[model samples]
Target: MNRPTTLALTFLTLTLAACGRPASTPAVSTDDTSSGSVADAGGHGAGGNGAAGHGDHALAAPGPDRSRLPSRAVLGPATVAPGLRVQTLPANVQPNLLALKVLILSSGPSDYGIGTARALLDQSGIPYDVLDASRTPLDTAALIAPDGSGRYQGVILTDSALIMDAGNGTYPSALDSAEWDTLFEYERTFRVRQLALYGAPGSVPEDYGLRYVAGAETATTSLRLNAAGQAVFSDLKGAAIPVTYSYTYPSALQSVPGVSTQVLATDPSGRVLAATSTSADGRERLILTSAQNPYLTHSQLLGRGLAQWLTRGVHLGEHRRFLQVDIDDVFLEGDHLTSALTLTAPFRLSGSDLLNVRTQQDRLRSNYPAAPNFRYALMFNGGGANTAVPTLCTNSPWLTRDLLSSVARCLNTQFDWVNHTLDHQRMDVMPLSTATTQIQQNLSVGTKLGLNMSRASLVTGEHSGLGFMDPTDDGTRNDDGTAGPKQDLGLGRSNPNLLSAAVSSGVTYLASDHSVASQWDAQCPTCGVPHPLNPGVFLVPRWPNSVAYHVTTPDEATAFYNSLYGPGGLFPYWDRNLTYAEFLDRESDQALTHILNGTPFPHFMHQPNLRQYAGGKSLATDWVQAALVKYSTYSKLPLNTLRWDDLGAQVRRHTAEVKASAAGTLSGTWNRSAGTVRLTSSAGTVPVTLSGASSGTLYGTDRAARYDLSGSLDVPVTPR
Candidate 1:
């Protein structure tokens, strides 16, 4: 009685096959102890020379003007300690863009002449980072520190940003006389220099790092680095460009509906006081908003250009989030070695590798910026007719230890203990005791290794392959051996039975054993196939179309998803891929497109260490990044929430809105608008929207169907 249907779909302990189960399935260097040069960021040439024009006599040789002569060039003068030490820029840049390396003798919160230069760099999108002089103490003692990441394209000031006072033991906001002389010495070297006359003329010294704020008549008379890494006269003016606001509208998300947006000004008649608008892409936008927008609560305003604009000269488009994920599972000594689905995460085996566990953790961290969704699940084997636990199952314990600790260090990615099974025993052979033992050992090891095994959402154990199925975990081979409980894709009565088994044994997310696209079921499967690994998506079950490994192929993977998610079928069915890598990429790409398209992202989990998804760097890390990009784009939600329940709800909401009409129709509403179409009916109202439906309207009686639906639809008003 393999009755597989949408109604049978339920959450249970699931397992994915390795390839298809049982059945199938920083550069940096520098002894200088200073940050990299500004030229490294490329803006060197006012044109793009890529490097600072090499230092030459042209820069060192000052004009014949007697007054402009160096004020006695000195380095770490014994009489006066803590002075400036100048160094050549590490790299060169375009001549147009003035670049140099200025060294400060000490640390200061304010500029010795650095702030002005920083402002210019930020405005130009030139890369830069600040290094504490303390990190490279040697450079500081010598009045130079170029060992940091910033390459020498621009000004490098040593201990210049630091302003310290010895007499009062507290450096004031203003610089001391000695500091002025140091910047003055570099004034001649600056490709562009500024000169300011003091009230006392020659008596006054150079004061660098200070710039004209709101209202200033002339540059600081003492010394200062102008916008161009040059010393300028008090009357010298640097370029200042008003900031330009820019936003992106992706072509992918231009059609979803139901999103209503508007632009509003604070004072009604006020000129663009503030405004919120929506574009084809799903992103929501608000401009000129006050720092006090309550809706931007809980630090929402912290990013999204507000804080960045305040601190950095430019605003962020959208920041990407990164995370590392490792597969983990505790195991006992009785789990099977070659069973259809092996319980690896929480393996009840005799031999397991502890270091392998740490390596899994390392893999996750490597994809840090990519924000990989790391996870661990137990792999379980299903018994079709075998009896007695396998002897080889005992070795699993030693093999599982390594993965356990790897997952314990991080919580960003999911780490769910799955149910592999006890003694690697076949369900048909052993009694309920087998499932119990597997769960116990799996949970026990997780506890021992410090994993949060208390609760998780994926239950990948025995016969629990990747996809949902029925008869897969029914009563098993009965005493008669006539016909085991009905079986199909694990969605039959077997599923509920499996759930009861999971709850009784403490397991969820049942992995469908042998769930991959097999040669037998690869033909346009109702549940989608990675199991019984096959060739094409449309071949019949009886055909000889074999697996293309297809995942490695671009086209095959696409067909698999379309078949399952296509209209009028397979709604909200949980499915798994043949390998960890395949699952990672397919799931992430799917979720991201859905999000970018403004559609709801589907909830899916990958079993790390499952040979399939965690194979190579490109496959593992790339897929994880795809997932992170999708998650980050949402901007307000976490990755975990994209689970069964949330996805179920979204499926329904979007389907109705995408298929039905808008609201206020009977209320004599004129053109409601695009994306969000509103309609009015005697019963109630129905509003429809999707990720990219620019236009379309329809009304009808609601019908229960797959894919999340709120139930019922609205009647169309022929413009009554």
Candidate 2:
């Protein structure tokens, strides 16, 4: 085939894969949650597997009303040489506008993802970054908010991005050389991160005929109150059936069309035990029943719910939302009062002694109950290898294992774990190989502890490892010989160090600090502290209310602070340098102390240190528990962890079964219909018709954008 023909055919297949739906399989079994609300998007009777495909190709001019045509057009036939890929993005979706960052979540290197995805993106010209998702649990603030890109829309997830076969067409979440290379071949890689649609909260009553809360998610776990209130859990994917007393958490994912909710199960203490979407069905309800009601002895209450509703796309008149900030990290290092309150020295140690240090450090919990609705976060403020000791984060293996084990049980109830890196290296400066190793180590540690997640979980920043990194990568090293960090974090600019690290390692969350919390009119523009890399920085008045970490000395503390009662300052709390005594005395003494000024004090500060306040057998457990309470109290919204693409699995499966009323491809019937463009082949006709310009850009929520030739294909579906 001529290069043009070949390119056209190739584009066709890629477009089909990109624009096609119902490609992914719903992993959750039928009625797995008891409501039996599963759909076959593009599959057979059962949910169909996610199969990538190329679609019809053929170029055309931009249609007058680009919004109406198929932004995603498929090529005619594979043999005819897959045609070129095409996309028609809404003008609202900017090439530089926010909406293309994807956080890939996976378990231990998923299969054949990066390579195939990268090849297509290269051929299709999409932008993205991949990170190892299986590093830490998906329940931390520091881990998920590393660069602050967590706010992006539409996070596309694939487990492990590995190419090795594990189940069905499924592969582990790991990657090899081919996948990495594919990524580089795609569109120019930029540091701009897009947000993922955290499960479009609440089903559209108009679209799905259901009324559900937005951004709600659910999972299941069992707690046995068998021994003196010590919580032991049954595997989430595994149901504990001891004899006839089978404990099944039949989760009812919302299947009905119009009725919706944010229902879930809670343990005895009102902690989120398992997340359930729908209500019970007749003889088909998911009942997490233990012998007698284990309510007191490790029993749970299956109906606690938070509400998160999306306010976008709706008419401005319908806009209404509560204050629910989804936080992932709030780290405190050394004596920086905040850090001292959050992080403790000798941080990454293990055993009883380490537990003691943590115990003493944990008094931070005493700060919890104070900030009820503050955005939440998972703490990774410290505990990586001691840089001077290099091997510290590595050597103190327990730093991860023992700690995570303790943390997981806690996480089963409170918040999600935002996985941070294994060794906290300044990603921008470190060698890619070393960065990979450090991240891999972190993933390995997560495995031992059983809190599986991808590099996407880590909320990271430019100042990892040997100090800060240069986001622009001018090749100048830091004063410490590391990649010279940036002095100016340009406006609306993000750090590439964290971006590259996240995508390469399959990380999901980016580290970022909210510059201010008040409206521009409320404070001085130049007063809020600048980001570490960007000096004399002024936060865009639009998004304020940010509290960033990465302080070891007192000086950094004062930069953001406004003495005691300044109107417009960086944080709502005292300087990180403040002593615990000062924190206590000054906080309540001076009604408007810096303590009460900036974004509210992270709930963690209110609680005691992970170990100090709460006594976990190990520091990790206490850390996890502290993180849980902090998040539970703060991330006040309901959460749905599945990626937007994952939801397509159901739609993809059902769509695959759909046979176009007309046999043959869109190209076969080209020229037959008034607007028809077709190509005839041996078996059937392939046609692509455009009422207008089918050539346009299809922009993803995350920065990745695709150009499709299909005038937006109009498919009408009657709501069930």
Give per-residue CA lDDT, model 2, range 171-218, as digits (tens): 332323333222212111212111111111222111111222222222
Superposed Cα deviation of residue 346, candidate 2 (Å): 6.1
Measured against the true structure, the TM-scores of the candidates, in listed sequence, are 0.28, 0.28
Q: Would you list the C-alpha lDDT of every candidate in the order shown?
A: 0.25, 0.25
- lDDT score of residue 630 within candidate 1: 46
lDDT of 1 by residue, 1-720 (tens): 110011111111111111111110000101112111111011110111211111000000000111111111111101223445533433432222211221222233321223323322222122333443323333211322233221122222322223223233333313333443433333322222221100111111211212112222111111111332111111112222111111101011112244333322222222122233232223232232111111111112122222222212111011211122222223322211122222222222112232333355356545443333444333322221112222222224333432323333232123433334433333333344544564565555444444444232333322332222233344353212212222233222232333444456544323332112221222111111222221111111111001111122223333333332234223222243234355444445333422222222222222221223233322233444566644553333233323322222343333233223212122111121121212233334443221111222221111112112244332222110
What residue runs in model 2 are displaced by over 4 Å at the alpha carbon?
A: 1-415, 454-457, 462-486, 489-501, 508-720
Give model 1 RMSD, 1 decimal. 27.8
Q: lDDT of candidate 1?
A: 0.25
lDDT value, residue 151 of candidate 2:
19
Candidate 2 TM-score versus the reference = 0.28
